[model samples]
Target chain A: MEILSLNQISPDQVVLLQWGVVRITATLLYTWVVMAILILVAILVGRKATADTAISRWQNLLEVVVSSIREQIREISQDEPDHYTAFIGTLFLFIGLSNLLLIVPGYVAPTSSLTTTAALAVCVFFAVPIYGISKNGLAYFKEYFQPTFIFFPFHVMGEFTRTLALMIRLFGNIMSHDKVIAILLAVTPLFFPIVMHALGLLIGMVQAYIFSILAMVYIASVTQAHESHGRGP
Target chain B: MHIDWFVFAAQIINFLILVALLKYFLYDRIVKAMDARQAGIASRMEEAERLRQEAGRHLQEMEEKKRQLDARVQEILNQAVRDAGAEKERLLALANEEAQESRRRWKETLAREREAFYDRLRLTSGEIIFSTIRRILGDMADAALEEHVVDTFVGRIRGMDEQAQELLRRSLDDSRSEVTLVSAFELRPDQQEKILSALGPFLSHDVTLRCEVRPELISGIELVSQGYRLAWSVQRHLETLEEAFKEALREELPEVNLENAGGEDAPAQEGSRQPHQSG
Candidate 1:
């Protein structure tokens, strides 16, 4: 078994299976592993979950994680968490889990891949409009042409740039953390790599929070446009 | 730095699938359970509040009942006290009235006893004095005294007032029976004739003269004609003296006749002192 090296910029470059045009990369394999772990834990803990005050430790932990995510969503959006809890919670869970798993030997973090980060950013980009339209109907698109027609292209460009920034930010931070930790491991191969790996964990969790919060902000700007517009220039 | 489009699309699909799975298995169930638990807690709190209020009301009702019972007890006690006081007063009044009646009866008995003592004293003293005087007069009486008594009687008949003479005359005229002369001593025939001759001027018609001797006269002489009588007797003089002594005794000891002083006994006592006459 070959360990994933710092030289590989993304897990996507490592192909696990190959066909004519269907190449199953390490990114997809690791993503599937993370997904399976999340699903399996959810099923196991959720099945035994009770409304009673006495709950299993696993159920308690899961509730804490889910509720914390809901709270964060509520705070960022300044709205009820129910509408955004699923998408936002999944993003944080998947990214946070993937980043946390970086401590394992030979484990390829899916979020370290440009493809996964881009995919998550794209979801956020599309979800913002979907949530906005659900909340404000077709009027949500009118925000793009606000103030005058002269600022229309700029608003459109700002949307694409923000989406691109969301992708690049998560990808760059996680990839850089992995690279730095791998480089330090190679250079010192001792106590220093442990510290960097610990730092990497912190950076990874912070990135997950940042990514989810940014997505929420973007979605809230569209969904709560009237409130923002009412606040004035 | 190149993005794998297939991997990107697959990752997006994987995330969307995860979102759906988590939403179904985790978020919905947890939120529902929390809501159900909150609702149960709220209802339990409501029930507790209701029970507390009912208990408060029951406590208040009990206190009110206790207050009413206390008031009733006080009222009954007061009424009993009032009744006891009334009974005490009534008993006291009865006792007072009985004591007054007893005192009145005692005074009446004392007065009755005193009146009886005085009557006995008056009767005994009058009997003693009159019996003594009669004994003295009887011891002194003789034929010569009888002769003087007949002469005095004849003189009294001759010295009678006109009214007395007229009353004697009317009595003699109305008499169908004998006119009698009686003496304590034997009267001589001449002396008797002298007494009858002195009474002759008062006679309206010829009436029979009967001579009788009575020792109870005690050295005195008497003449009787139906409803009219003339007497000269030491017994009469003694009776007048007894009456005078009784008047003096009544003046000296007012209490002796205090019981009958102004009553029916007074007039009857006064009538007893009148001269002996029959209509």
Candidate 2:
């Protein structure tokens, strides 16, 4: 192989840090900082929170944000508000922090990667019906071979396709927005980039909402399965 | 755009771990909180319903007690009114019975008083008549002196016509049409002599004289013919005067309770000495 010159090397660079047997990357360092900030803020604001009265300004703001997530969870749980409040609340916070990290100079949206979105989708796919099964027992699994024996193949394929669809949808939207901002910065380094960055911010928040709501919906759909046997999971 | 598989793979792992962590640590607590809230709301609603039912029961009890009190009060009032009515009726009945008994006693007392007055008048009139007749026939002790005079008068009256005798007998029989005659002595003529002289022609029979002293005929002779007698007496005039006095008393005594007045009016000896007989 011909050795390439310095001019030919890619602009991308990597710096690695090791702690014992573990290696931490620059990207992971950014992710950790974002996570740490989110956690500290969440805990400090929620320290003395109560259902009866507003605790503080920060606590009240956090409560408003959490209440919206709780509303979506309630909808996804289909009036079973007891099932998904905390799960969806945490999901919103994590993804929101990850998406907001994109505003930083060197950080990227974790959800912009196919692997990350796929992993999230897979967790949702497995967790949704698992909770459904746990809540309703083995009755959830029995709902898969619905309609008739001849329609079983179609139903099985549909489940795989739906989960794949969730992965692709989130990955595509976040990746495209990141790419568009990068491309705009390369073309013009001025006001155009600022608009694209703002758009990225908007899209990021929307994607977080969509993903968390969809996961909650998945959990709800399975719980409603036994009531409607003719429909597929 | 450039692709970075390693970064993508790490992110995918990170997202999966986060989702799982949240599901494990956070969801259970949130669900518990939500369930607790729901239970509290349900309990509050149940408590409210219980209080409302209790209030309704209390209200009904109060209403029932009020109704009972009102009915009891009304019953007492009605009983009192009925008792008052019965008392009024008893008093009225007693008053009416007492009034009727008093009226009967008053009428009996008045009749007794009238009979007693008439008896006293009759006794006084008899004494007057006996004294006056004795004075008028004084010194006629000869054996046929009064008989010769009566025979001469009776022969002259008998010699008249039979139609004249029947007229005299009719006049004597209708004593109410006789006029009063002026006489000093009280007359005590026999009813038989008067009848023989008055209707001798019509009877064509012998007549005899038998004197009878009647105090009711005080100053006039009474003539008798057939089954009738003609009478004129001072006692009759006194009876008219007593009738006038009784009429005046009746007119003046509209409000008097005369049934209780018997002890007041019996003090005079003249009023006490007479016999009482009521017609």
Candidate 3:
């Protein structure tokens, strides 16, 4: 008999394979599953896409999703969305898809694991500087010393803290929802877990939006810092 | 919460791969199609605007051409009217000239006919008057009348003006030709002696006296010396009376222009004289 408990907060506890220190956990497996699902849908829908006014519903849906992401990126960054669409759009889709799949029986979202959240947050952490440097060159570091060098250390610490905050915010929200639903099922074992599952869906979508939006804000700050500074308040 | 380094690394790699794949398949293709659709819409709008402007220009040109044609039509009509008026005036002038020429020719014809009538009347009147006179004189002829005609000749010589007498005297002195006396009847010996005694005053010297009978003289006598002649006759008196009647007729009918009457009167005058000459 399998015993269910709330002690297992992440899918990492389940190891699918072990090769002498090379171990594949449930998080990695589910991540591959999500990736495969996204890639397959993209390929299928892209195959028949056309620029004509009359289009398939699937193409229309895909176009709506893409243009919405681009519009959001443009609004946040105050610049063209082309440079950041791939990175920002993928982050939203991956996390959004993982959270949406929560409705499936026995399915574990990859975002529920601390490792996946940390990985996404780490990616955003590095993307900010990379986009900023591409726009402003080495001069991107000058933002640290802005308003006098006295705040330099605080500015440096701000970067690491923000990255940690991004990871914990997504992981805690999704994992707690999952853990609460498990507890509710074990305790009430009735319609209450269903209601929490519904709540979990809302929280899941919000987390995805917040994560992507925060990432864009960070990126725009660096990419457009020179322009903002040139405007003189 | 425990973090697994391997899982974290693998998830990052997965996300990066996902980004690359979705960009290639979805974002890039969709964005390209949308941009192309927008460009096509803009081009069609521009083409529509150009066609509209071209249509407007063509309409304006057609209107202009129609206006010009209307003006041209009006001008042509005006010219036709002017030409018609000029033609009407020209025809009227031509008609007037023809009427004037016709009137002139008609007047000329009437004048010619009138002159011919007048000439015939004069000739007829002269013939009748002379024929009557000749018959009367012929009925009265006798030896007593012949003696009286000689005595009348003698009286005419005695009644001559000084100028006439002087002219007869000069002619008798200048000529040595015979003095000839012609009479309508044969004179008795006493009658010849009477004519000789009547001419004695005009003769400056003795000349031969010749008496000739010429019935053409009617009831008259003539004395001839060289080219000079003295005559008294009824034919002369009748010719003078005819000329006076012609003058009176011409004055009465003034519209008859008698300037050319003289040429037409010659034959009539000669015809009138023939009866007397034969008589």
Per-residue C-alpha lDDT of model 1 across residues B1-279, encoded as one tens digit per residue: 899988888899999999999888878876666666678778888988998999999999999999999999999999999999999999999999999999999999999888778776775666576678878898998888888888888888888778777877887787886888878987888987888788788776777678888886678887777766777876556655666666876786765653443222121222222264221
**Candidate 3 i-RMS:** 1.0
Off by over 4 Å in 2: A1-23, A230-233, B1-279
Model 3 regions lying over 4 Å from their true place? A1-5, A187-192, A230-233, B55-279
User: What TM-score do all the candidates reach, one by one?
Assistant: 0.59, 0.46, 0.57
Ranking by TM-score: 1, 3, 2
Q: Write the per-residue lDDT of candidate 1 for residues A4-123, one digit (tens) a residue.
A: 666778889999898867889999999999999988888888788787778888888888887888888888788999999888888888999999999988887898889999999999
Candidate with better lDDT, 1 vs 2: 1
Model 3 reproduces a share of the real contacts of 0.75
**Candidates arranged by lDDT, highest first:** 1, 3, 2
Candidate by candidate, in order, the iRMS in Å equals 1.0, 4.9, 1.0
Candidate 2 accuracy as TM-score: 0.46
Clashing pairs in 1: none
DockQ of 2: 0.11
Model 3: per-residue lDDT, tens digit, A133-227? Answer: 89888888888888789989998899999999999999999988888888788899989888888889999999999999999999999888867
Model 1 error, position B134 (Å): 43
